[model samples]
Target: MTDLALLQALGALCVEAGRAILDVYDAEAIVVRSKDDRSPVTDADERAEEILHAVLAKLFPGVTVIAEEAASRDGAPTEAPETFLLVDPLDGTREFINRNGEFTVNVGLISRRAPVLGCVHAPALGATWIGAAGRGAFKAEAAIRDVPAPAAYRPIAVRQRPAAGLCAVASRSHADAETEAFLEKLGVVERRSAGSSLKFCLVAEAAADVYPRFGPTMEWDTAAGHAVLAAAGGAVTRPDMTPFDYGKAEAGFRNGGFVAWGARD
Candidate 1:
């Protein structure tokens, strides 16, 4: 499939994944477990990841994947192949457990160490952001999926506001005093709370702008959304405002503090 088509196709996978997550999410007596880092995990995360990997492998045969649930369960992929899939099946386990409905399914395509195409779907919230390099970002409401095989496709762009009142995107569960102190310096309008990498989607779509994440995030966390926001005319810069550098050998699939904004420099 063409890269643009690949993005939309993956978008369909995201929708399916979202439905599975919601199915488990709505079930009675859901159980939550703690990983070694004390972060929460749930059956939904595992089941969604399993389905996603199966679908992705079929779609792109021979493409490896760095899936969170699989890595968490079977241990990290022994080798990081040059080209592979990056999946975060369930982005907001805390929000899922809290039943706040901000969780998401993130699927990213990283080509030659750069985010090329991606999709983020929040089923319960009925929102999705899909993008591809050289093709601008778009949002689709889940409710419109049945109308003539889908109809609500609107182009999305970053807010071109001057740096006066920035909308600060933040984590729903990982909020810390340090990040709060950092927000104070940005002339934030207010905290826009979202679970998982959906914070990046908010900035990508200009629905909200400027997400400064100081906490730990792996490469998979940002790559997909990074592509979306970058394609939408946004910037993903280091804390000091340098453009972000991914696929560095030393970083080993890890990411550092970076600001994602819809408008670029």
Candidate 2:
């Protein structure tokens, strides 16, 4: 598919799944379950992932799609081609359960183990961000009833480092001592807390200067936002300062500690 076509489809899929998530979010009671890994899974997660899987199957026939809830049930494929789809229908279940409106639906296309296109939709926030390789990243008002086209989106990019110091973003739920230590080392002027991929989005749009994660994150957790950051002239790299790679079933798709930086440190 052409870049624009793929982005539109991904944006629509993410928006649709976000609507499904909101359906459960607004309900009286939301059922939650624990997978083997003991992570909480809610009705919204499964329902939205199902919506995404179905649409992705139709959009890209025969592509290997790795979705969080589905992989937990059916097992992730040990091997896949260079190109595939990764979906995290509900990226911040904790925030969603807490009714914080910080959760997001993430859909990413990976090529050569790097995210090429991605869409992060925050249903409760009524906003979505999308990024495509060579085309740049954009943000749009996420309409629950319809997916806005790229024409309705605003292009975004990272900013140069501030003269004072770096503004850092960290996980609101998973912040830890190690992460704090890392942030301190960055000469941060101020620290911000956020849930899900919004941390990466903040850096991508230059709202924050850096995001350092010491806690565990799955590929689906970071892929969409990583793509956006990268497209916006930012980077997500390991503590060792190497590029992050995906399709790691050996590690159960879990990601190591990493730092996301805007244009400058």
Candidate 3:
């Protein structure tokens, strides 16, 4: 399928996953459990992932599917494929458990080791962002059951660096001293906290200027948002300024320190 069509399909799937997540989010209490890694998991995370996996398997029969929950259960894919779909069905499980609205459902299509199209849905916030390479990016208010319509989304792009200084965003749950030092060294004028991949979307849409992540993150944690940021004329790079590539099986699918930039810097 074409990249734009793939993004649209993925966006729909994200909305569906988001709806399932909201059902759990709006209920009385979210039952939480720990995975083998000791990270929290909930019914919402597993259910959303199940839904995504079903639809993806049906939609693209041959494409390799790598998902967070599945990886935790089954282990990382031993070999990287040239193209694959990565799903973090419910990112920010901690934020979701805390009843914060910062979590998201992330769907990313990786081609040739790069994210070519992506959709990020913040179900609780009623917003979704979609982007494809060379197609730019957009954000729109979408309900749980609603499918994405073109007119509902407004085109978005990263903004030029403000004369004042850079506005930075960091993981609400993962922020550490090293991240603070990185921001400080970057000469940040303002620092904000957000959960999940929304921090990347902030820079993607120019809501923030940069997001420096010094802690651990899996490829699924960042690919969808990375695609959106890249399409919006932003960049995600390693500390040495190299491009960030996906499907890193040797690294156990974990990412090293990276900085997402809205400005050219």
Candidate 4:
């Protein structure tokens, strides 16, 4: 999967997973379950993961998967796998519960501890962002096939920070006190709210300059957007400014606070 062609193919697999999610979403409410972490899961998550697993099993038969919906303390292999896909079918069930149109379908492909390809689809919002290392990153918003069109793809980069004012996105429902303190410290002139991975997409598009996640979020929650943000000329860094890496030996599949931006590296 190191080759450019292989990366692109993996991206297409991500898109297919998105479509599977939309199918589940378009149907009526399905069963919702609680994981050990007590996070919510709908039929959408399982169906999408199943679809992705089936496709990748054929495309990259030996590639292991570490999807959020499929993981638990019960059955994780004893050894860490080298390459895998981290999938999040419904990123904001809370938003989906409120019918706020903020959830997304995300898929990330990682090799050697870094995201090489990723795709995120917001069926309700009709937006899709896709990225691959070196080949560049792109987003699409169109109705045709409800899918992204390659011809319309444009390379994205983070906008330079404004000297006088900066805009940032806080979680619409989870804008905690620390997020407020951080935004206030950043001296943002205005603030917007979005749900799910849309927060990261906002920064990637330069619609907003930054998103600081001081709250809890798993690896699946950020991995795809991390790739997109990085591809869009932005980065995700810890409070110490060290870039978050995937495929850690001890961390399993978790994430920590980081910022996303649209600016020069």
Off by over 4 Å in 3: none
lDDT of 3 at 52: 98
Which order, best to worst by lDDT?
A: 3, 2, 1, 4
Per-residue accuracy of model 3 over 1-265 as CA lDDT, tens digit each = 7766666777888899998998999999999999998999999999999999999987778999999999999999898899998899999999999998999999888999899888899998888899989998888886656876867888899999999999999889987889888888878999889999999999988899999998889999999999999999999999889988998999888999899999794
How many steric clashes between backbone atoms does each model show? 0, 0, 0, 3
lDDT of each: 0.78, 0.88, 0.90, 0.74
Tens digit of per-residue lDDT, candidate 4, span 55-137: 76776678777777667534444455778777777788887766676888787777787777777778677677877777767
Which pairs clash in the backbone of model 2?
none
Over 4 Å off, model 1: 144-150, 162-164, 248-252
Identify the superior model by lDDT, candidate 1 or candidate 3: 3
Compose the digit string of candidate 2's lDDT tens values, residues 207-260: 998999877888999989999999899988899998888888788888998989
Largest lDDT belongs to which candidate? 3
After TM-score superposition, what is the CA distance of residue 248 in candidate 1 from its true location, in Å?
5.4
TM-score versus the correct structure, for each prediction? 0.90, 0.96, 0.96, 0.88
